[model samples]
Target: MLPKIQHLLKASPAVTALIGAGTDPITDPVRVYRHGDAPQGVVRPYVTWSVPAGDVENTFDGADADFFRVHVDCWSDGDVEVEQLAKAVRAALEVEAYCAGYYADERNLETKRYRIGFAFDFILSRE
Candidate 1:
């Protein structure tokens, strides 16, 4: 991973380093708390992602290194709900450019609530 990606992941309050841990291509989504302070009759969905390494490019002027990409998938109980949450998270992360995209909903055969899922990808690089 690029230094910036590593730095960000290492700095996450929800993450910890596991010594001698094997590196795998991570594409799994994790669930997290939406907010620390709860509101009256409101619940939020928040998720954090691990940084995954991508390709690297070397150049004479400077090495344009694309270290990795990080994605946080969020879900909410209504449409555009996940999108809004994702936007907030992106803003907090200071990633200026991203694509807000939607995907299929995952649910069990039993009880289900109105669920929405959206994702935004981040590309980290240094030249």
Candidate 2:
């Protein structure tokens, strides 16, 4: 699932490159990167992910179940133009959402990160 999502995002024209592990020494302990066009005036935003939901299940008659879950988050550094940021996010997610062919899904904005803060969280499931 992680590879699939990474591939989809990496294939996007807007995405410039994928900064995998052990490239940066000054960054966090997670895999981070600068994605999107840089020379073409695209701000390479900071991207990170966490698997907050692990595979587990309730105990009923000593039964076991498995579930796949994760969260992929991307955020821009410093103050960037809201319009550009929105366009960048839409461009990235458009390809990630199975090429939805439209960028009009639901989004919720959180102000804890920026002056005009926002975070796009897409809950995905593949059966």
Candidate 3:
């Protein structure tokens, strides 16, 4: 797991509240996980992220900085629902670039329930 991913997980109080943790009961508070294996049974609405590949560099100050290719996957039962969840995630990440920005890539799923999926790619930095 990426260290930054864990950091975001741990530092999620504000986000949790904003995304409906204690206030809403049905949303399940937009569950989040890292490197979670898909179960043999059911998969609920959630967000999963992973570091596909990355590099660590030792700077002149003798400290290492890690640049990771992070992929965030958002899943829900509806398009608007998944999009709302994705928006919340993108807001929390708050990442930006001059040329590259957030884009939604839809995925098709074969399941017992109708599902919508969205993906986002980002270069995450950790020192």
Candidate 4:
């Protein structure tokens, strides 16, 4: 699921233009990462995501779907840049997911980087 989400983000031209089309989408150090795994010295306007919460959808018949609550964060050196990147990320993922909520923009006083976060809900069929 993480790989699929990363592919969706990297494949969007709007997103790549802001972050970068790293040499390899799968191992791109600067474009995207699983939450808290970003490399040191990563460039600005990158993205991180994680499935912080999830569950199996069980029915009378059987469990037939997976529900995931994914959190995507865009980090940049400035507010405008982070917002734009967040917009792109939202657009890229909305095809298969819906926005569940938004996290308030945050500014880290120590690193001076701005971050905008969004939560998305994804349901995948187990069949």
Candidate 5:
């Protein structure tokens, strides 16, 4: 599931522009991680995902549906950069699926980093 979502995001032309620019360390592809880990150093926005929510099976169809939450974290040395990345994330993902909720965590004083994030609640209909 994570791989599919990652591929989908990376494949989009708009998201691709942000990830493929290679203008700076932060301008590379958004690192999509299924584990709870992130790149260490000053870099661009990356993603880490948690174990998703429960699965709700649909007997009528070959797919199993679930209201899963994908937590996206945007990291950057500057706040605005991360915020923009987060917005890109929303634009990239929300347009593709049914987004039930959204949120943002801009910064943490202790970390001195920008972490604009969102909880994407979407259903996965698999065959």
Candidate 6:
């Protein structure tokens, strides 16, 4: 699920324009990582995400789908940049997932960086 989300964000023109398409997508500026995995000194305006909750849906017949509640955070050096990055992230994910909505928009006092966080719900077919 995280890989799928990363692929969507990496492929989005809007997102790439803001972040970047590094020579190597895996190590590039768009810099999408699972929460707490981004390396120190990463480029600005990057993205980090996590699945805080999830469930397996089963019917009388069998399990059919898996549901995940994902949190995506955008970090940037400026307020406006963070907002734009968040919008791009939302746009990329909303194509294949439902956006529960934004949950946080604040500046980290210690780092002086803006962070915007949002939630998304994804239902993936087991089959």
How many steric clashes does model 2 contain? 0
* Per-residue lDDT of candidate 1, residues 1-127 (tens digit): 3224233333343321211111442332223323222234333343434333356667788856563444444445544554555445444444433544544355424424233344445554573
- The residue pairs in collision within model 2 are none
RMSD of each: 11.0, 9.6, 5.1, 2.5, 3.7, 2.0
- Candidate 6 lowest-lDDT run of ten: 21-30
List the candidates ranked by lDDT, beginning with the highest: 6, 4, 5, 3, 1, 2
Show model 6 residue runs off by greater than 4 Å: 1-3, 25-29
State the weakest 10-residue window (summed lDDT) of model 3.
Answer: 95-104
The alpha-carbon lDDT assigned to residue 57 of candidate 1 equals: 64
Q: Report the Cα lDDT for residue 103, model 4.
A: 83
Q: CA lDDT of 45 in candidate 5?
A: 54
Best by TM-score: 6
Q: What TM-score do all the candidates reach, one by one? A: 0.42, 0.36, 0.61, 0.87, 0.71, 0.89
Per-residue lDDT of 10 in model 2: 47
Off by over 4 Å in 4: 1-3, 24-30, 60-63
Residue pairs in steric clash, candidate 3? none
Candidate with better lDDT, 2 vs 4 = 4
lDDT of 6 by residue, 12-69 (tens): 9999888787557666555888863568888888888998899888887775888999
Candidate 3 vs. true structure, TM-score:
0.61
> Candidate 2: which stretches are off by over 4 Å?
1-3, 17-44, 54-69, 81-86, 96-127
Give the higher-TM-score candidate: 1 or 4: 4
Which parts of model 5 have CA positions greater than 4 angstroms off?
Answer: 1-3, 21-30, 60-63
Q: Judge candidate 5 against the unseen true structure and give its global Cα lDDT, from 0 to 1.
A: 0.62
Clashes by residue pair, model 6: none
The window of 10 residues in a row where model 1 has the poorest summed lDDT is 13-22
**Model 4 per-residue lDDT tens digits across residues 34-113:** 86457888878788888889988778776588888998888999889998999899999998898998985999899898
